[model samples]
Target: MAAIELRNIVKVFSDKRRGRDLLTLDNINLDIEANDFVCLLGPSGCGKSTLLNIIAGFEQATSGRTLVGGKQVERPGSDRGVVFQQPTLMPWLTAIDNIAFHLKLKGVGKAERHHRAMEFIDLVGLRGFEHHHPSEMSGGMNQRVGIARALLMNPSVILMDEPFAALDAQTKLEMQEELVAIWQKRRCTIVFVTHSVDEALVLGNKIVVMTKRPGRIREAVNFDLPRPRDITSPEFNDAKRHILALIREESTRLAQAS
Candidate 1:
């Protein structure tokens, strides 16, 4: 059985001022197998983030079903970890404290929480900075803390919505490499939402392209290129070209329709 399943999922929102309902997702069907790294790639406003939110249980689909580990997803649970675009770490809490905050809420003793959180802190390469507050860290470092916090939960799936979008080019590249390494080590299912074709290509073994507003899956492209992918190679460029063509084709179709 697939690790995650989406069967004819649809989402719509009320546009109160406009006196009409806006459809954001239209029948998004997908099956993500265990340990699959899937990237949802699309243009802006394509509902990629919305789809991610639905899977994270932050939003309910207007219709159809979302299942994870053979169970329906009704609300946010610890079985799924989510990392947003912003690190969203507490400004006052030190890195280690923030990462272990969930454990604290569960009434775990400080020593035990520290022990468990330290494992994730090391996993995310934040050993030396564990005592620093979010304000004391760089954007990349704070994001690392956020990732550690999520992983500390030891969830079966990780859902990320453009978590690296805010970093500088070099920092973003470094984080990407670290994330790929972490994912390889953990071997967990991940559904990452991003608008960048290159980012998707670099991180995902499976890429699902979505159409413009009222999003639908255009195609699910299997990318089996080896790890530490060469972005300039023929295979990489070929995949990029194909993905771009799909986006362009969708754009042109929408333009013509309008």
Candidate 2:
């Protein structure tokens, strides 16, 4: 069975002021296999994040179904972890404590929580700064803390909505490398949403492109480029070219329609 399934999903928003409903997603169907690193690639306002939210059980689809591990997703659950564009860490909590906060809520003893959280701290390469609060850490470091917090739950899938969009170019590249390493080591299914073709190519084994709103799957491109991918290689450029063409085509069509 697929790790995550979106069956004929559709989403609409009530535009109260406009006195109409705006369709954001239309007849989307996708199956993400276990351990597949899937990137949802699309332009801004294309509803990639909405689709992700549906999979994460944070939002309900207007119609159709989302299943994770063969079970219908009714609401947010521990089986899926989500990291947003912002780190959203607690300002007062230290890195380790923030990562272990969920465990603490479940009444886990302090020592056990610390022990468990430490593993993820090391995994995200925040070992030395584990005691620092969010306010003290750099944006990249805080993002790592958020990632560690999600992983400490040991969720089967991770849903990320452009988590590196806020980082500086250098930090973004470093985080991308670290994220790929973590994904390889953890072997968990990840559905990442990003607008950047380069970021998608760098991180995903499969890239699912989406059209302009109302968003629909344009194509699912299999990218088998070896890890530590050579962005300058012919193969990488070819894939990027294909994806860019698709996006450009979509944009042209939308412009014509408008």
Candidate 3:
């Protein structure tokens, strides 16, 4: 069975000011295999983030079902970990403390919590900066802390909503490389949402392209490109060309409708 399943899902939002209901997602279905890195890629208005939110149990679908690890996802649970666009770390706590806060909530002792979090701190390359607070760290560093926090949960699935979207180009590339390495080592299912084609191609083995508002799955392209992918290779360029064509077609269709 698939590690994650979205069966005929639909999401609608009531636009109070417009006095109408907006259908954001329509009859979407997807199956993600274990340890697969899937990227939900689309334009800004696409429901990619909404889909991630549904999987995270942060939003309810208007219809259909969501199952993760053979269980219905009715609410948020420790079985799934999430990393949002922003770090959202606690200002007062140090990086290590923030990473192990979940353990603290479950009554773990400070010594044990720190010890456990230390592994993830090293995993994310924040070894020497473990004691730094959010304010003391750069955006990328805080994001690493957020990722470590999520990893420490040992969840079956990790949901990321453009976690590196706000970083500088160089920082973003570094984080992407590190994320792919961590995903490979950890061997956990990851569903990442992003608007960047390059970002999606870089990180995901399976790229699920989504259409604009009233979102539908355009295609789920299986990349299977070798790890430490050569972005400049002909194969990579070919894949990029195909994806760009799909996006252009979608944009043209939308233009005609308007």
The list of candidate 3 runs beyond 4 A from truth reads none
Colliding pairs, model 2: none
Which of candidates 1 and 2 is the stronger one according to lDDT?
A: 2
Candidate 3 C-alpha lDDT tens digits along 172-211 = 9999999999999999999999999999999999999999
| Candidates in descending lDDT order | 3, 2, 1
Q: Write the per-residue lDDT of candidate 1 for residues 1-258, one digit (tens) a residue.
A: 999999999999999998999999999999999999999999898899999988889999999999999999999999899999998998989999999999999999999999999999999899889899999999999999999999998899999999999999999999999999999999999999999999999999999999999999999999999989999999999999999999999999999999
What is candidate 1's TM-score against the reference? 0.99
lDDT value, residue 175 of candidate 3: 100
Model 3 residue 183 CA deviation (Å) reads 0.5
Flag regions of model 2 displaced more than 4 Å: none
Instruction: Report how far off residue 129 is in candidate 1 (Å).
Output: 0.6
Per-residue alpha-carbon lDDT of model 2 for 97-164, expressed as tens digits? 99999999999999999999999999999888999998898999999998998898889999999999
Q: What is the C-alpha lDDT of each candidate?
A: 0.95, 0.96, 0.96
